[model samples]
Target: MVYDFDKLWNYNKPADTEMAFLKLLPKALECGTDYHLQLLTQIARTQGLQQQFDRAHHTLDEVEKQLNTQAFPQAAIRYLLERGRVFNSSGNKKDAAPLFEQAWQLASETGNDFYAADALHMLAIVASPEQALEWNLKALHLAENSADTRTQKWLGSLYNNIGWTYFDMADYEKALALFEKCLQWNEKQHHPMEVFIARWSAGKTLRLLQRTEEALHTQTGLLKEMIDKNMEEDGFVFEELAECLLQLNRPEQAKKYFAAAYNLLSKDIWLQKNEPARLSRLQKLG
Candidate 1:
């Protein structure tokens, strides 16, 4: 039975989809064609997203062995981009940068603006603060000018990264503005997930700006949307709402959300490692 891999991926359940790919590997091998190479690339990407870096690299190595770059230029670009993503996620940005650069050059030469913008956006993510904005803006330009729906879909992510680069540089105003830009694009795409993510960034930036009232409004709306969508497992939004409630001197409301956040966060090991302090504070709120 052939699986609709794209549909599986779009379900946003990467771990399960990756497992499905693994189970299908035997059937994929039976076909014994370059098409399996593309399937391997998809599996590698899911592994990268799961932070199974070693496994991802192994999968990518198989793709490299089978890839006919002359015939599959787009797949070549995908390979480079996925390899770069794995390296970047693993904190080997130096290794990642060259891959992204190669992808950018290849995509540009192929006149594939979608991939060109993707490669540039990845380069922006790994670039230093001084260069990140420039790379991001270049990607943004391609995304803005392109007619491809694929490039248009990238708008929210490009704006979100630009906003974070500004945030990291402590340019709160620019960060807030760019996050707003992300939401506008997300709305245009009718992508609720990206809109919520952009709202989270905007809300956090508002808090940093000491615009607590605005933050409160943003968090309230975000929390409502999340709840309505039954996406309460996203503990960060709960935490954001709680923080805003705390600032508004509503301890009772804040405590409930803090507890909710803690409950959800405890199940996420990545969040546990990245936000130890937040977890600690949430405990105290109880």
Candidate 2:
């Protein structure tokens, strides 16, 4: 646990994650302890951030070797979730399905409702748009059964996710309503990530509505917050904001945003050569 937390703080989304390797002793990990599983999960997450997919799986395997199935059902659920996440990240949704199912089943049988709900949430992400609603609604059911405030917040995130899925499925009316309600949960929690995501979603849906000026105003705040936090902004976010700017007949402002987005992404050598949208936008600006 100490090691994991230390690594998180030191990195704190630091760049060049492949160069950020700090090895942990296998013996330091005591299976079934909250900290142990947390360490394993963090290592997996770190590898994912570094884009080292195989390394992440190897770390999970180490944790698996130490965990006993009979004694650690909750941990079992966690392991499956982590593995499923890696598969999802790697774009291997089919491989992730069974893992999520196993975790969901274990969480249910063990009365670990929160874990069950979490599994359902991730499972829904991998499912098709048509099938996703069932998974999310099932997750909501399990979440409703829990008494924890944190659990409720998670369920709220699940709802937000469902709303996004609906939006992707071309159901704007449903998406807007769900997102509006999810804002209440985020307000109560007042977490940065939640606020950031909620605003992003709102702005996105408004754009779909052709409410260009409103969407620009909404995302502008989020952009300032991201900059203030010194966090990396997704190029897609900036591109979308520029789209709104163009719709608002603000090509000058659009040029600024387009440049900013392309520049930020262009710093990464790999993406500089690879991202046609950003690169082409820059060329167009020039």
Candidate 3:
């Protein structure tokens, strides 16, 4: 309760967040309620986010050493969940699934529906599309039924993931529906960043569905909202708007947004790696 891991939640830079967690560890240890171990769990998570897999593994080992299955049910579930997450993030879903399943079992036994839903959600992520949908639906059911506020907040994430899975499988209608659901849940949270993300997904899905005008409208509105709120400027939205304009034959507007997107996104290593072709086209437009 005293240790605020929430501070790390919105930090996009995992390496910096990991350092922040490390700085808090000694002070957290003095609190004397296995708080240090909980902090270690978060540190391991940040290491995984930073792609420091081996260091993340070592941190989890330390967690394993301190974890008591009987005495700390919640912590035990978190340890297993974090272990599964590390393996999942490291691209070892085969190893990850069992850990998530075990965590699910532990959470169920402990009557912790929030963690149980989380394990199911992770299982969905690492599974095949059809199996993933099944798992996701089950997780959604648990989340919806739980009285815990944390579980309720998971609605947006579950919808977003399922939406993307549908999108990847080329089911645009289903994807759009789920993305809309995500947007609805995010609106309830009134978290600007999350709402932006949900809108982005919805707009992208609209583009995939060839609803160019709708996609353009959605992205345009979202961009204005972000600008008004001084929210994190997402290059993806600009790129999406550009593409939508291009599809609608507004070449001049498209070119402008393409240039804007290029200026913002060209430095992103992940974009450079995964979307080189699209980036190249954006550059050509610029």
Candidate 4:
């Protein structure tokens, strides 16, 4: 029986995903050594995503002991990618970059366009701003040209990454354009959460471009849509709405949203660890 690892992933809930992967281990083992090792790599990835870097490394280390790069090349690629992710998430981009590069090279040589694009996208995350765009564009082009649907599925994320790359470069127009493209792509793919995120990105760029009214409209629409869909409230959406309201000189309305944003976002472990100042500002504003 062929197991689909993608079915086990829930990126928004890494701890739950970790448990799901652990439960699948027996089935994976019955499949074969290759499937087992590949599954182990993903277990390590969940650990990394949850900020358990040491545990993630240890998990990858166990996988490495049994990994034969020639016999299990796909597993080897996954191991490299997961290990690199642990390093990158732990603030060791210098160590992560070489592993991502190696994975890219190996995957490309093995005709694994999906993993190749994955490696390049990881490279973009660790690279400098100037180099990040280069990596993202390279990954985007590869995904666009690949005949493999798995590889082609990377296009939406690539578009979002490139949009943020442009956003960080302070080219708001280009960022907005790419984010709009991301929105369209996600809509076509029927990924509701991704479409929401893409809309948020585009709205944020509008505010940066000094189109405050339009930004406010966009964010308000998103908030209404989320409520209408009975979706969980998004802190980022609240944050954006606060910013838009503040820009429009509505301090009382902004304060309410700011407080809501802080209440939700302050619970985010990654933000608490990496962006204390941002949280502080939100608290003060609230």
Candidate 5:
């Protein structure tokens, strides 16, 4: 099993990942039909992540034509998972759920714990708010107990998802605890960006818990760290800083950060489409 597709993926830069997979296609073809088909599934995934939904579907269609369920079940599982992801990412969750369900069942039956966990995580994303926690917990349990290191790598993300679910349910304390756990997991894994994201999650939860000073400290530290590391400025960090300042009755200081946040976050296509109200509020506040 020379399935090293993970090395080609950079979830934040889907276009780059797509190109990487495209470059690897010839090599995959030489490996075997199973490897080729599985690689195509990942290419489709990269396309989906880039919002190239039609192209992704076409790629998956090609994979399906060569799929052999009996001889290469893993490839089949990958195809279903990628197809479901494309539908889910395109806001067609209604059609996506069954594909993920099938993937989950097939992956579990095949003893592919990694894809089974992936399917469960995707299900958590598409599930109703009331059912999301259950799906996330199921995925988390599977990942935690898996002997496979790749499967266990899901723990940080699972913790973050569970934390957000709790946050949405108004269980701030629980959310904070889970976010802290996520932070610890990422730190242990030595994933710097994931650790930073986890810290951001915890900071936001702190504000919601009325720990204003602590939240302010955390956001300020993140801002300083980003500057020191020469990392791209995150609008969410600025937004959190502004929020903390506002909560402390320092409107003047808050306004500048709000302006900075809006200037950057307004350029986000997903935020523009899905969170217009939030952007509008930032605009008005700024």
Candidate 6:
């Protein structure tokens, strides 16, 4: 098969970006692409962005096949990052979890601040509170030592997410402190999405602390901005906003937001791919 005229015959049809990459993979070694692992990952991400998990995995398969022959060792961090993301986005945490573990070890071993921070950020999200706090702090440490703007933005969001985790654990003071740090870092970086996340978390933390007046006002303003930005249609953001409203003794407003969330999520055909198991839940929400 290695010497065949068309070793990747099935992939030659170019039915999709994944296949095109697959077809060229055999000769990738002969060419100048040491980043084929990254290439497979890039294509997979494009598929993932399109919400096509099956295609993303199919591309990942090609990457695994190429690695079996001889992989470019330096690209492992990027490869694992993409692999973890594909697994996570597809809701296969069981499968995705190991990728994060691998990525964490690889990044630490290589002393790559960017990849290390990213790996830690991902691991923190799925970890238990104790473990998450450890990872989040490590990510913060790495970001602090790096001069990369992108790393700062990611670290800021990680802080906010860590704050959220603590909030869920009913540690309002810790959540508020972490969220304040998140806001400070994000403000310096100027990332609006991270700012939004920070604000939402802040409102929640404030509500948990019984700062109802502040929470209500902040959330009200944030909701208006979300609506204006058209982000009210995002299921996740809608859920966040709804939680805030519900806490403010505004169940009716919460229901309206949840109903809108249901409507937005019901039409999410993108998530439908490779997620039939979620359809029932989506339907219930709808």
TM-score for each candidate, following the candidate numbering = 0.87, 0.80, 0.89, 0.98, 0.97, 0.72
Tell me how many residue pairs clash in candidate 5.
0
Relative to the true structure, how large is the alpha-carbon lDDT of every model? 0.86, 0.74, 0.87, 0.95, 0.93, 0.70
* Model 6 CA lDDT for position 40: 65
Q: Could you tally the backbone clashes for each prediction?
A: 0, 0, 0, 0, 0, 0
User: What is the model-wide C-alpha lDDT for candidate 5?
Assistant: 0.93
Q: List the residue pairs that clash in candidate 6.
A: none
Q: Positional deviation of 146 in candidate 5, in angstroms?
A: 1.3
lDDT of 5 by residue, 1-286 (tens): 5768878789999999989888888789888998899999999999998888999999999999999888999999999999999999899999899999999999999999999999998898999866889999999999999999989988999999999999999999999999999999889889999999999999999999999999999999999999999999999999999999999999999999999999999999789978999999899899
lDDT of 2 by residue, 47-160 (tens): 765566898899889778877656877667778888888888777899999999999998889887777888899889999987888899888876776886546657668869
Given candidate 5, what's the lDDT at residue 224? 95
Task: Choose the strongest candidate by lDDT.
Answer: 4
Q: Which stretches of candidate 5 lie over 4 Å from their true place?
A: 1-3
lDDT of candidate 6?
0.70
lDDT of 1: 0.86
Question: Considering summed lDDT, which 10 consecutive residues are worst modelled in model 3?
Answer: 1-10
RMSD to truth, every model: 2.8, 4.0, 2.3, 0.9, 1.3, 7.6
Best by TM-score: 4
Lowest lDDT 10-residue stretch of candidate 1 = 2-11
What's model 5's TM-score?
0.97
**Candidate 5 residue-wise lDDT at 231:** 99
Model 4: lDDT of residue 99: 97
